[model samples]
Target: MSKGQQWDVVSGVGITALAVAAARAVETGRPDALIEDPYARGFVGAARAPVKLPTTPAEAEAADGRGYWAQVSTYIAVRTRAFDDYFRQAAEAGVTQAVLLASGLDTRAFRLPWPERTVVYEIDQPLVLDFKLTVLREHGATAGGVHRPVGADLREDWPAALEAAGFDRARPTAWLAEGLLPYLPSEAEESLFHEIHRLSAPGSRLAVEAIGNIPGALADTAANGSVRTLGVDLADLIHTGQRPAPADRLTNLGWNVRTVPATETAAEHGRPLSPAFVERDARYVFADRPPRAIASSAMSSVIRPPV
Candidate 1:
């Protein structure tokens, strides 16, 4: 990863955000949609995309004539639903503070029925957040709760920036890291979780969409030709290599962790994913920090006093 690379809403990794938004727009138009993101189409429409992006299911099918967007759209829809349910569960459990790491064009702050007095912090690049806010404001959209946009690179000192934005480390928070892990180098991914653990209070919750391995299509020239046609090389955007597993890391850090295969989640939602996507061993990881007493006891057991 570059030390200080930057991108806007239509270039580099920023384009990937637009792609996801397009998928969300398609999903929202589905009659059997699991999640409704009304503003997703607006983001896709406002962007000057390098390639024509589909904002409806028919358009998605036509664009997938090469059989790329179909699987990707389904996978993105399933993933979005899973994370939406995660946040809803977190809210129902009375964890009000929420943080979306690398939050790109996500409309959750405006869409989700967050409890009263909830505060949602979105952390991402300055330009990315600025673009999102600009478009949402044009549509006359307002967040359901307190929305704090922390414009800081994830590889840098985002924790301090988040705190400066009125993030309370003492209160339990619901954190989401969707479509973000693969973009970070292995070491940086580790550092991200460590910082999150440090900043989290007891009873904090986390949801991560972890990519277990490089997708086969990206590694195959012929198979990935369809992707390149879209004018963005995902392989170039992501860091590929072995990394610390998020579930294992959080478990060792004293949080109760559960791992669910993406395929299983898709199956549960009655939306089967293509093997091209699931063959990668992608999964969702949910973890919860125990209460203060239980966490302290668990830490003490893991770390004994010096003799």
Candidate 2:
């Protein structure tokens, strides 16, 4: 991927964002929905997707049976619910600041019940952010808290842009990297986390949707299927290679980390996913930095008393 490549809501990586919204819309209509995103369908309706994107369960059923869309819809629902809970838990823990990296078409700031005086920063390409704000504004949506959009490339110096936009590094933050890592090159992924670590304060938390390594054959098959069905070549957009696990990287950076397999999460949510659609190695990684007092106490305990 180029350093400053751009795409709108209907093309490139941007279409994937719309696809997720469509999945959310379908999930919202379920009687036993994991998360309610009333605005998800609106985003889908506004975009002119190159292929038929299902916004309802019936439409989704017609697209493919027990196929790509089926697995994606279920997985997206599970992933959305998991991240939603992560944010809620962070809020309950009194960490009021939040950042959504590559925050495309996600309506959390508008739908999630955030505490008063909370601030949410969304970082993405300028066009992507503009498109999202336009669609939401047309629907007369209001954010639950202070909403700031940082329009900059993640591969560039976004931390400076974030700081300029009043991101408080000293305050505990709840950061999310949902469905973003795969589009980033290996080096860029490393840089992204390093920046996150630098800006995060003690007591901050992070949640990531991490993908496991994909075999070349599987990758080619998936990519070919997507192009044939969706009219978009996902292979061109995705960066595939062996990289360090996000959980291990965060642990080494002094964050308490936990990894949960996507299949396990699906079962826990009572929605078992098909392995064909969901990557066998896909997982969610949640990590939190220790508060300063706890770190200080631990350091003190390790030191012997002066003779």
Each prediction's RMSD over C-alphas, in Å, is 3.9, 2.6
Residue 240's lDDT in candidate 1: 74
Q: Which 10 residues in a row give candidate 2 its minimum summed lDDT?
A: 215-224
lDDT of 2: 0.86
Q: Which stretches of model 2 miss by more than 4 angstroms?
A: 216-224, 293-306
TM-score of 1: 0.93
> Per-residue lDDT tens digits of candidate 1, residues 190-281?
99999999999999999999878665645642375635545687878787787778999999999999999999999999999887787777
Candidate 1: segments with Cα more than 4 A from true spot: 215-217, 220-222, 226-229, 294-307
